[model samples]
Target: MQIMRPLYVDPAVPGMAFTYVMATGGGVAQADRYRQDLVCGPGTQALFTTQAATKVYRMEHDYATQRVHLTAGEGAYVEYLPDAVIPFAGSRFHQSSVVTADETATVVYAETVTGGRLARGERHEYTVFTSDLEIRRPDGTLLAVDTMRLRPEDVGGVTGPGVFAGHDHVASVHVVSTRRPAQEIADTLHRSLADADVLHGTSVLPEACGAWTRILGHEQPCVTAAVHTAWDAVRRLLLGHPAPDLRKQ
Candidate 1:
């Protein structure tokens, strides 16, 4: 496990503290388990990200698991934007992230999944890839839940009619904010992707707290670009600030 010092990169948003969690000892491997927790106090803003992409290496034994927990207090704003997650051939991995926030808190989260090392002719070769994300109020009332269980071998591969067909990368963004109109935000995000070379969609979440977006493309850059576009829209609508370049390598 690696933890790095925080940085003050955004002059326009001085109130939002940014931190990087460096993953040491290389990337995830077989039989590895990781847990992380983050808290944002009332009226404070923060951002969290990894130093690099999370690579799930090939495994010969048990699979790996990663769990993350986050808490945001009233009037707080938080964003968790990690790099892409690359699952190498013969890998099995599971990840879960849960966020508990007060009714007034706002959050933005994103994830990207690639079709393995396409240049090495690796695609849909992983044994299993599972991810679950949930958001809830401080009282434990669930506001939203998103789960993905992909087993290419059992499902006849990741590419097929109606299933990530012709797409080598996928990305998604979730924005939770009670201060903005959910449908309007969704419309704005949808418009932002009108010229992108990808297949994407957006919809408001339950109870109109916020919205979500999903995008599929043939390359990682395309999907990530779409996600960034959506994030820009969210930032403008919810935070009234422009999206800052993270400058990730």
Candidate 2:
């Protein structure tokens, strides 16, 4: 535990939520960051988020890495929704997550990123951002496999008509709920964002198949608003109330 990290959370919320960074492998880091930990108890509702965009600075020796562990209790719902991560040039980082969910649990989680503040001449031309994610049931069996990367030459990023669609700031929302029809929820979300002055799209997958939504636009404001709109609509229909915990500052 040589690497010191900042871990934050607000248990006073409607449910339980936390985020922090802790030492992982024996790798020597040129610097440190705040890691996150999030969870929920039976029948409890929780939302977890980062205070701001997590920045991984350049490393001259070895790779800086993070591992996240998440769980949701029976009849509980949780969201670890974090904003985009901006990596500076030459920075190397690896992120991985293992999420376990009970049969009665429901979750909506997402992670996104931008190249950088291009307006101010900031760009992550030669930087590398990598995240490997997996979802599992209570028994520890696998449910999904996701490998994501952001680089100048990597096609490992999102694509296709249902994916990024040429937008810079992109998001992937994974909702696990059976209380309501996923298709109906996505339909209403699309209709809600139709008139907005933004370019975006949404999709609904099968029950065991998690759903995905892609929003592409220039400004983060528009993209963030559109995502919130969808999250809000789905929350009311499924959780019996808007996600008060997911609201942004």
Candidate 3:
């Protein structure tokens, strides 16, 4: 893993630093184990993103796993918005993310996953793809937990009514913050995607701490646009500013 030097690209928020994380191997291979820990000190404002989409290559034997732990200190504002993850045929992978935040901190986290290489007509051909996410307070109090297990060979398959619902791409955004009322945050998220081209839903987080939204669509562009809309809404509500263009290549 390589982290680029901090860049001040957002004139609206001059104090916020933007950093990009790059994978030296370009993609994840079979039998790979990766871990990442990110800590934002008190009163700091930062955003971290990946240089490109995470591609999980086809596997034959063992599976790949990635673990991420994020901690936000008091009054810190941190965002981790990475690109989509594309699992090739026969790939098996699992990812676990744990977020620990102080009551006064604000953290925005998002993730996107595609069914497969849609251009190549590969859809849900992977053996298994699972992810677990947990949000907790600094004192170890659990706030929320989300788990996803996608196995095309399962009893009902991933395209079932309650699962992907035949969507090719899925994305989610979570905002953990005390800067605004939870219901207001949820409403903002909902309004952002009310007329969008994708299917989405928003709800307040546990304990009325913040809000979150989930988006699903057959096209990647539609889903990605909806995700960005939700994020921008939340940013405007909490930070009094809009989301900046990362200018990613």
- State in Å the error of residue 53, model 3: 0.6
Pairs that collide in candidate 1 are: none
Q: Over the stretch 123-222, how does candidate 3's per-residue lDDT look in tens digits?
A: 9999999999999999999999988899999899998688899899999999999999999999999999999999888899999989999899989889
Q: Where in model 2 is the C-alpha error above 4 Å?
A: 1-37, 153-166, 206-210, 245-249
lDDT of each: 0.88, 0.64, 0.93
TM-score of each predicted structure versus truth: 0.97, 0.76, 0.98
TM-score of 2: 0.76
Q: How far does residue 104 in candidate 3 sit from its true spot (Å)?
A: 0.3
| lDDT winner | 3
Model 2, 9-125: lDDT tens digits are: 333343444432323443324454434455667886666665556656557766677777788889887777766666655677778887777877888777676666557566655
Clashes of each: 0, 4, 0
Model 3 alpha-carbon drift over 4 Å, by segment: none
C-alpha RMSD in Å of predicted model 2 compared with the true structure: 5.2
Model 1 agreement with the true structure over 1-249: per-residue lDDT tens digits? 766777778887887889998888788999999999898889978999888889999999999999989899999999998888999999999999998878899989898888787889999888899999998999999999988878898646768755678788888888888887888888888998999999998999888878888889998888878888888878887888888999985
